[model samples]
Target: MKISPLRSVRVTRYVTPLREGGSLPAIVEADDGFLYVQKFRGAGQGPKALIAELIGGELARFLGLRIPEIVFSDLDPALSRLEPDEEIQDLLRASGGLNLGVHYLSGSSTFDPVVNDVDALTASRVVWLDCLITNVDRTARNTNLLIWNRELWLIDHGASLYFHHSWENWEEQSVRPFAQVKDHVLLPYASRLEEVDAEYRALLTPEVFRELADLVPDEWLDDPASQRDVYAKFLTSRLAHSSVFVNAALYARNALV
Candidate 1:
């Protein structure tokens, strides 16, 4: 699939801080007159987290999953001056540049595993996508899912693609099974893994991976072109050996059932 470049918007107002996670993402108003959940480049996880969020979220979207629109948000240093909190002020100052934002979903509630019921097909697709990306989040404790307009929406994928955190032995990491699948919130409902696996594997081609890699911004990477190549290589290699993780998720689901 040919993906268009992300829309760029400048942050016009420094809204309230979302203190849910350690990274301190905020609901900021953009120049386009839209509120966004802005993930900062200056956060503890740094630019790498934004990169993972972009790649993982877009990949989910490409695979027919619901993800809030991701965009390139420009932060201005002057926007921090009105903030009383020293820490937030520091964060705003540090994040002055290109950051990541997700279009804020108004009135959306967090997906509670105990309260929500997901269909086997949806569950299976989510499980498969998480396994493919080696996402460490999405456990029962924090699903990172939202129920907006009564539809499940995936979010906060900064915890995915962790192999990039330490590039050593990244090739080996690519083919490994995701043991965390056992703790996945959707595993119990994912009865159609085999079916979803077949469909997703076919949908995500080498070209798709390349396109996803190309979507990442150059400023985020040390070696823009080469690192993009590395990301594509890692993802394509993981896709090539998807069965390793697929079987792992199947075993986990079977155990849950």
Candidate 2:
């Protein structure tokens, strides 16, 4: 299946800083008259976080998971001048180019694992996706999930695909089992991992990875050593060794329960 490119928009207004995470993402209004949770390119993690957000979110969507619509939002350096906060001013100046935005879910609340009960299928899928991407932020502490319109939605994938932080050993990292699965928020409920694994594996192909990689903006992959193809190659290699992480999750879940 061919994936469509993300929508592009210009930031019309900066609403407020989220302040929850170190990156200082904010809610901003785009030219399209919609609010988006904008992930700035100039944040502490730099563009790699946005790249991870794009690839991880799109990959989950491709696997039939619910993800907020991701968009390419252009930030104007002039917008920073209007802000009184020197910190935000610096952020806007640094993120003057293309940034990432997630369609805001107006009244969504963070997922509270204790207060909410997820079905086996949804839990399995979430766990499986996290494993496939080596996402480490979905622990009990910070689920990075939301309940919007009475449905579970995944967001904030910047912490996934962390191997890119140090590309020197990306090949080995691709196939490594994610031991972090033991701390996963949904691990206890992911009883259907074996079943979901078989299904999701068939959905993720090399072509699919390439298509997702293509969605990433050329500007985000500006690192001299990291090209767009590298993203595709990393995921494709990881998928080939899916069983390694799949088994790791299964083991963690068993130990947990």
Candidate 3:
């Protein structure tokens, strides 16, 4: 488990607020370049949210999905000069401090909530991955997805599986049905059921599983027995239904790719 050192960043000026995440995320210019700085919030879920941003984002990258660059840093609260409405400022302070940027969504904010212009085929691929990873987010309301510059980008994985680990149990770990895969904004361009199944089977290699487990932060894996048990249960459960979800995705995208 290697931790990357936080780089020293200098903010030139702040860009307008994006949206109010549990914490208010902002766009800021750093000495090196532009990056999203998410100030830490002090709520009960803040730590969990940060963990999801780090671990889940990295795992998605490992599984060959398109994700944004992410890192951890502390904002020198003094540098931020945003004058939010009094209520908003109080909420901001309650959140922790000034920060900028989060998972980046390229281009304008238009293709929000989910990816657009995708057919069933493409939707299958997205659904298969989401199902396997137990991504409970990406629903219609808070879809947590975006498309920019004609490429799909996933954001706000904080609501995914591992974030709520404490409340999870082995018995509750099962693949949810992908009946709505095709209509899912992020999964509209799905592959046919057959192809999606094959791809899912091919991608869930034991090595990939092990590596993904390894990326879990030491704090989460802090206890060897607990970590091993959790990973073992997670992998076994996910692998058990890989074919079903994968096939569903492929079936959706039968005509294309």
Among all candidates shown, the one with the greatest lDDT = 1
Predicted structure with the largest TM-score when compared to the true one? 1
Question: How many angstroms is residue 172 displaced in model 1 relative to the true structure, after the best TM-score fit?
Answer: 0.3
lDDT of 1 at 94: 93
lDDT per residue as tens, model 2, 141-169: 99999998889999999999998887778
Q: Which parts of model 2 are misplaced by more than 4 Å?
A: 223-226
Across 22-141, the per-residue lDDT of candidate 1 in tens digits comes to: 999999999999999999999998999998999999999988899999999999988889999999999999999999999999999999988988999999999999998888899889
In model 2, residue pairs whose N, Cα or C atoms come closer than 3 Å (at least 3 residues apart or on different chains), thus clashing, are: none
Question: Candidate 3 on 1-257: residue-level lDDT in tens?
Answer: 32233233444445555565545566655556665645344433655565555545665665556666665444444443475555444544554332223544546354554336765545555566676666667766666656667766667666555525674564455554555454455554443545765766765565555555554445433474566556545655766777765666556545323
Candidate 2 lDDT score relative to the true structure: 0.91
Error of 1 at 221 (Å): 0.6
Return the TM-score for candidate 2, rounded to 2 decimals: 0.97
RMSD of 1: 0.8
The lowest-lDDT stretch of 10 consecutive residues in candidate 2 is: 220-229
User: Which residue runs of candidate 3 sit more than 4 Å off their true CA positions?
Assistant: 1-16, 20-22, 37-44, 76-103, 112-115, 119-121, 162-165, 175-183, 186-191, 216-236, 244-257
Tell how far residue 48 is off in model 2, in angstroms: 0.1
The positional error of residue 110 in candidate 3, measured at the CA in angstroms, is: 3.2
CA shift of 91, model 1, Å: 0.4
